[model samples]
Target: MPLGQRPGDKSDARYCGVEVLDFPAGEDLPAVLNHSLASAFDFILVPLVDPNYRPAPGSVLPVSASDLILGPAQWSNHVVGKISEWIDLDSEDERLRLDSELTLKQEIAWASHVSLQACVLPAPRRSFCGNYARVVNQILQGLTNMHLWLRLPLEKSEPMDDDLDKIKNNSHTSEIVDSWELWNSFRLLCDHSSQLCVALDILSTLPSINSLARWFGEPVRAAILQTEAFLTNAKGYPCLSKRHQSLLTGFFKHSVQVIISGRSNHNVFPVSEGVLSGDESYAEDSRVRHALTPYLEYIAYLYRKMDPLPEQERIEINYRDFLQSPLQPLMDNLEAQTYETFEKDVVKYTQYRRAVAKALVDRVADDAVSTTRTVLMVVGAGRGPLVRASLQAAEETGRKLKVYAVEKILTLLLLFIV
Candidate 1:
């Protein structure tokens, strides 16, 4: 289920997910999923394969669970596959690097078989990851429907500043690589594939506001909120600091989903404690609530507390990101529907009236207000909306005015004159 029903928001940010730290052993995925859903989470990020498994001759892929354990829709919708973290294609050991590459491919193929919509790639281990970029680029070429979200850390800029100073003071010091620079290099190597996106690992302390603003323009699909980033309130509940809360709010606005990660710090008990109170028979029903439910609830609270979308914003929400062909007024006739939509903008017309009134008041002195009339010419007036605004402005300012409109389109001129 969604976190909450926001009136104008139809984005994925409404859904909150939890990361499953340990592998769900022995086909226990369904049980884990049910617990998370019952605890009010919308999805779960689970490991696709066992972390300990390494590729070998005649060895089968060690997956957490079989593909048939869940339906195709369940795998594609409620679950996001996590690539095994141990794969290090950039390692110096030739055997380890080859094994890591084989394992990475096998896991991705398994995820594709299960019809998973997306998979989160592990963060690159080294700064100079040319081999890593090459392999991911190969995978992207054949990938059809699924998207590869490259995970990157949102490191605080304090260390970056210190590193910058070291570079200036000493020629021997190597400057630290920025996360954005890493992403840029990887994506450029991949030729900027549309399927490539990012999942940011948000830490406890954030970077400078200017440094943080760079990500708002990037293709950020999810923000992994670590549990350690939260602070325990007086009531022993998990809550984010002011900066984290603001960052989360910005993510919500940009349609980036939130995934709660790390061990639960607050000692908040399972959500089923209250419902199963005094019922010993059903107490240990083997279906316990999720420990991270409190964090999800707090995130939902932040989402619901946001102000409702304005009516005008709601009406135009459908046209948010898609591109439309630019209208050439000189080459084409103005459509009636376009005029109708433009005239409905009450605020635009109000501003026009105010500007006209100010100009009238400034030009006509108090003594000349009754004797002399100011001639106002509205060039390229479309159906005389501006003409009406000018007349209304003159009436309000108590100044005499003469109005003339110039329009090239005969159809528009006739409509306004009539």
Candidate 2:
């Protein structure tokens, strides 16, 4: 039950004490094998060959050809060093150099055989352990037969098959098998299996079905069905409980429906008559409704969750009051003469006001240069003619004036401003 124990470790009942093997340097190792055996008390605890270590020719044992094929190249020197130390090796650099050379030649031969054998083997059989082991051992045997070793100590008494058989029949046995199957099938279903593993691993760690669905893929529904079948038939293994299985299945089914609905071209208003009428029955079908329900519910849930924030209200202003505000009174006082004239001579008011405004403009412009002026005004200005005249006069006189002008008759003033 301890983590890192090999799958076969629990099968034996006779508790043979653990042994630690040491490979010493500079003694003809093969000649000194008897001494090593004697030290083991006839129970040899062979150390795992550090994958980095290259074994002596005679020490090599036969292994599956497929297993012997070099795996992915390890680019890290630190990892190579650790492996070297574990195998009682001299240096990682030396081992790596030798491995690279040997692997190139061995891989070519392995590849040729693998290609030929692949053609002969059935798809399912190619995935089987027996076939895989045969291919793996061929490459390993070619490299060095000494890589294989028994890790467990040998029993002084003869081993019995019955106890081993009983252990093989235990509840955890199929779990061990399933783990192996899952690991071996990994590359074949990389996209799907990896995604499923990530989703399940995350769910195991965080227990959130909703978050898990975010990463679940298109094949999730099919995978869940397959997983359910495996759990049902997998005797003696602690697979997912029925309740968990049902929940996972329901979740995947719901997710699939949600995705389908999201990708569907259902519209509130169909552009063409044929478009809406073509699949009316399909749209109203019970199956379609069932599939879309979860998606609709989820959307509604999100909408409800976001409906409580405060909203801004725009302030409304009245133009009539704005025109008569405090700023307007100052403007009106500056143009009081124009207002007084307009109220008096209503008929000839426009022409008389134009002349008065022009004169006022001239006076303001002349005075602008004589003082640091704060305000300049043109009174009795008709249609703002005096304002234009004042600006022209100020330009010619080389003076800076802050000009404000008023025109008699509201219509004329509006026209002038526009």
Candidate 3:
């Protein structure tokens, strides 16, 4: 039924789900951010900007004020605190100077109030030829010990050169580009905090997802594997090339905790996962939900194939926490997709029905009539899933109710009514 394509027969009150906003890099600095919080957004994703990049007198950077966030004012929320990305961080002189130029006094100050997870970034090459150590040390020192994530460049190729020859003669370790030398080098400096991790950026340019496993080098593997996440640039859906899809997913069998990012428009800045999914919604459909299903199922399939969890590990993980990962928690729109009734859909909705019934019930039996008789209205009614959920809730409560679904699309409305 594709959810909203037909009139909803169910009534639900918990249908007013949470919404998160995504703010792209632009002008208006504090205003946009403040507005997002004021609107009660669960979260806001601002593009990573270098707070201290000072272009040479003659040089100009292609960026805006919004792209240059100072240390954020401390607020209590989960923020992916990222370093400011500069346009041109090429050469040793520039790299060495980074230790002096980059500062996070304000950022850390903000973090003391709000929770800043990981510093998301692509490698910050100190020179055309340096391991990730220098840039990493700079972050460690600046943030005073925070988790650092290396989002292996998805489309950009690392500079390649003759392997061992350049090492002695040219003194260039461009060879590190092909493997985990950067991560390894950083390990030598690591104090072994939960702060060192990897965020594999899935892309066609990846030489071999298989190669990454070997590069992990058992010990380093165990340490950071416990501290891993995935990243990808997505359009309406995961921007995985057909050829790389299975190979990439298979490589990270349980890495469904991927952070999906994308450019919002012509300015070519990043947008939040929420906006990307909601903007691409088909009626009430979220693009992210579509993208999440198959991947999570794939992960579950992998889980079913795994060795049983150790009792000690199981004891540490709460029943709910067992599901937490680098990925965001499940935040679905709740309306079932009617057109495609897969086994997963049936399982999902059935569980949701049980939950709604449980959550909505009260000891006051007479109140059920008053509660269920309450009119249900769904604004921007995409397909009819919310309406149906509402109806379901009302029926479960044994209350009389009328549902008014207002949708801007006449064709969609007609389809639902018919």
Candidate 4:
């Protein structure tokens, strides 16, 4: 049952705010209730009027009623944009599934003006048409303009039910390639947003899980994009093999999300216990299963990693950071030749040089009075990328720039000049 309602109350949802938002007992109560984010709701799902039920609101979400669904499991009140899939739109055109303009209009016309945080589509993973790339590009544009998020499926077999029923094929192949391809696609969209996340249904068996769990190379993992995907169907959580469960458990322990589906009015967890109550108290009892069965199960035993405070940085310290300090040690007796060798061998030096040039260019662009030509001196111009970037920036901002490229080994400098 919902938290504050009586046993016979018709409006069954507890955190939905339909009752309060629609028919508040008092005026100040709504403000008082939603004031402290520490006690706010996730999202307030509203009804869409007739003739335009599947309206999309894009990023014009309500400030008081909604906040960005931060870390999924770690919110005070977690509400997301909701559209009733059960509603009969009376149209056979499934073009909304992959049509970018259709998608955009739906998003912009969202009846509730809710930010389209993460859109849930009907099994676009298993069968996207020829227009998927364009659809993805359209979404990528929204990410920058309004910080929209898309919840593309990793694998889906639901739509195959009609054909499968004729042949009665309940079996599934390990869509490992699909997961990899789709994951890679989401990652390749260029990180305008913080992370490129896909929402994967959790009903699949271990082979697919293992494929995804195996280490993606460091360069791929360390790309500007973050692969912070989410998992759904916590009801299927116990189905994973112990090893695969451990793998998912470890991932969610970091700032990841798990969404559970259940009846609207069922008691998921105690209102007093807090939103993400994955703690030690319920480990040995039926309470954990019972709670999770209703979207309230937080198996803290499975996820042992601690989340840092909002004020603190995410402390993902690795062993390499221990060996190599950020501040390079200046050996008192260092030779210039040794320094030159080290500089030449450093793979990141080129990138660092380009970044420095970009920063200098940005700084010069910001300055109003310093109109004299900005002299960019690349100390170790091993390759010409830094010089090119400087020239490009100067051109873009209509600023005068003079480049001075210096290399200790004149052979490298001369070779480049030639």
**Top lDDT prediction, candidate number:** 1
User: Could you give me the TM-score of model 1 versus the true structure?
Assistant: 0.79
Tens digits of per-residue lDDT for model 2 on 1-418?
A: 0111222222111111111223222222222222322222111121213233454555542212222232222111000100122221112366644453443333334334322211011112212333233333343445321121101110112225765576677733321222223333532433222112111111111223453344333222111111112221233322344444444444432222111111112332222221112222232221223212222333223323332322110011112112342435334444546444334433354554455446545655654666644356766455555565556554555555577776555665675568
lDDT of 1: 0.84
TM-score of 2: 0.16
Scored by TM-score, the top model is: 1
The candidate, 3 or 4, that scores higher on TM-score is 3
For each candidate, the alpha-carbon lDDT, in order, equals: 0.84, 0.30, 0.41, 0.37
Estimated TM-score for each candidate: 0.79, 0.16, 0.40, 0.38
Ranking of predictions according to lDDT: 1, 3, 4, 2
Better candidate number, 2 or 4, judged by lDDT: 4
Between candidates 3 and 4, the lDDT winner: 3
lDDT of 1 by residue, 1-418 (tens): 7878888988888998888887775546776776677778888898888788888889988787877888888899899999999989999999989998998888888888888888999999988888988999999898899998999999744545666777778855764547888998999999988889999999888888887899988889999999999988999999989999999998888889999888767767754432212222324344565667788889999999988777777656656544667888778888989887778778899999999999999998888987989998988898889999999999999999999998888888887757
- For candidate 3, lDDT tens digit of each residue in 61-150? 323242235344322232454445542234457554553243333333344334455555445453242434544555566564455665
* Predicted structure 4, TM vs. truth: 0.38
Q: How many steric clashes does model 3 contain? A: 20
Better of 1 and 4 by TM-score: 1
Compare candidates 1 and 3 on TM-score and give the better one: 1
